[model samples]
Target: MCLLAMSNSLLQSAKKVILTEAQAVMMLADGLDQSFIDACQLIQNCTGKVVLIGMGKSGHIAGKIAATFASTGTPAFAVHPGEAGHGDLGMITQEDVVIAISYSGESDEIMTLIPIIKRLGILIIGMTKNVNSSIGRISNVHLDVSVEKEACPHNLAPTSSTTVALVMGDTLAISLLINKGFSVDDFARSHPSGTLGRRLLTLVSTIMKIGDDIPIVSADTKLLDALLIMSQKTLGMVLITNNNNILKGIFTDGDLRRVLETYPNIQSLTISKVMTPNCQSISKDRPAMAAVQMMDEFNLNSLPVVDDNNQVVGAINTHTLMQAKII
Candidate 1:
């Protein structure tokens, strides 16, 4: 019974923390004003990269914000305030825009580099709770990221404050992303290894089986002979084409199962007699993801790749999409 009580108490604490942080984020959203707009303008008009700087826990949030900006179209990177005081300050150029995050708005390390940043004529955008604080006062634009209280039971620990700062960073990045008319293709280019990149950038032609790898048989070929090719190709389907390689029909394992129940002597039958005529086919120029969607929509496991004139070029199956990580 005591164990159950402890478990309930732990859950209550977790729920309370989540609710408190959520409410703080809502308050931050309601408080958005021209300062947010001015900071965004400073970043959008900058000729160089966006530099993010913070101390301690704020530094961790700064790194994440920098990554979000870089992935979404803006060029940005995080620099530790302590490091900037040492020689990393050189990383910031006059064309670059600096976004300094200090919840207290008085990080000594960041303050130490302010004069040098100013001397370089770089623009500063500060994110903090107090506009009158030292870092905020020096900023060209000050974004208020204040919260009523921390979610921590002791009213300390950077809980709600950090969440508000992170959300503000996201708000800034997405706003800039929309303002610049960034497209999915652009985001994919920045993330070539991600699932979105694979779906958008990978072409069917690149992953489809070509040449002799495709299980192709003539219309006149025996059904058993086509089965041998299907086994060798391991694509679970075979394409029936004419002498000119123009696709005439397709035969899948499902067709073979139905054929077995209908025909007593399937070995002597021609593939054209049992093949699915006018079956769905994809163009080589289409995205690989399009092929996956077509397969799902038609309840198919494999699809043939053809050219503009419907001449067979390649083939793909569930295995192909799986190997390419498009599914």
Candidate 2:
């Protein structure tokens, strides 16, 4: 019982920490100033890559900022200040822009590399809480990421300060993305193995059922025959086509159930008499993510895939999209 009580108490404390950090973030809107605009302009005008450097928790945030920039159409990499003094400083080119992160702007490891970075003719953008500190005074552009207080109960850990710094870094990356005219497709390309990429890059033709797997019936076919085709093809619906193989209508399991409710003898009724005409259909070349959006917009479980000529070439179900991770 004592151990369980201790665990519960720790969880409650953690929740309070997170809530305090959130409150600190909500207060950041008032701190936006001209310095923020200067930082953004410096990064936007940079012709070379952005080199991020920091120590400890700042280093972790710098690494994430580098990744965000790279994924958002900016070339960037994180270099450790300690590593820079050893051999990693070679990664810095004269055309690059260095972004140094230091909460107090007094980290000796970071300060030691500033002269070398400056001597190489690279521009420096400093992120710090103290705008009057050495790093801020020496940098070409200084971004203030000061916070009211740390979320840490002891007021010693880097909590709210790191959050503010990360937010500032994200703001810079997003602003550059807009200035560069980056699109969702470009982001998807950068994250091809991620969920966003699967949603945006996967085409309808990649997931739709084709050839004999497609359940198709003539517009004049009997309802019973369509049901057999749907069962044989194992797709819950059957596409109705005319003599030219153009899609005319669709009969799904829901339609069958509704018709059976009214007719009670739907098996004897013709497909044309009960089929839903002018039903929604997707193009084969359309993005699977677009199809998912359409399905959600129309509240459908299955959709017919058609070509430019309005011919039913395939069919796709919600399960197929789920398997492709398009949801």
Q: Where is model 2 poorest over a 10-residue stretch in terms of lDDT?
A: 23-32
Q: Score each candidate by Cα lDDT.
A: 0.94, 0.89
The TM-score leader among the candidates is: 2
Q: Candidate 2 versus the native: TM-score? A: 0.94
Q: By lDDT, who's the top model here?
A: 1
Candidate 1: where are CA atoms >4 Å away?
193-202, 220-222, 258-270, 285-287, 325-327
RMSD of each: 2.6, 1.9
> Candidate 2's error at 24, in angstroms?
2.4
Question: Candidate 2 lDDT, tens digit per residue, 1-327?
Answer: 699999999999999888878877777667778877888888888888999998999999999999999999999999999988999999889989999999999989999998888898889999998878989988998888887789888999999999988988898999889987999889888988877778878999999999999998997899998899999987789999998889999999899889878996665688999888999999999989888889899988899999889999999998888888887
Model 2: lDDT equals 0.89
**Per-candidate total of colliding backbone pairs:** 0, 0
lDDT of 1 by residue, 205-270 (tens): 999999989999999999999999999999999999999999999999999999999999887899
Estimate the overall C-alpha local distance difference test score of candidate 1: 0.94
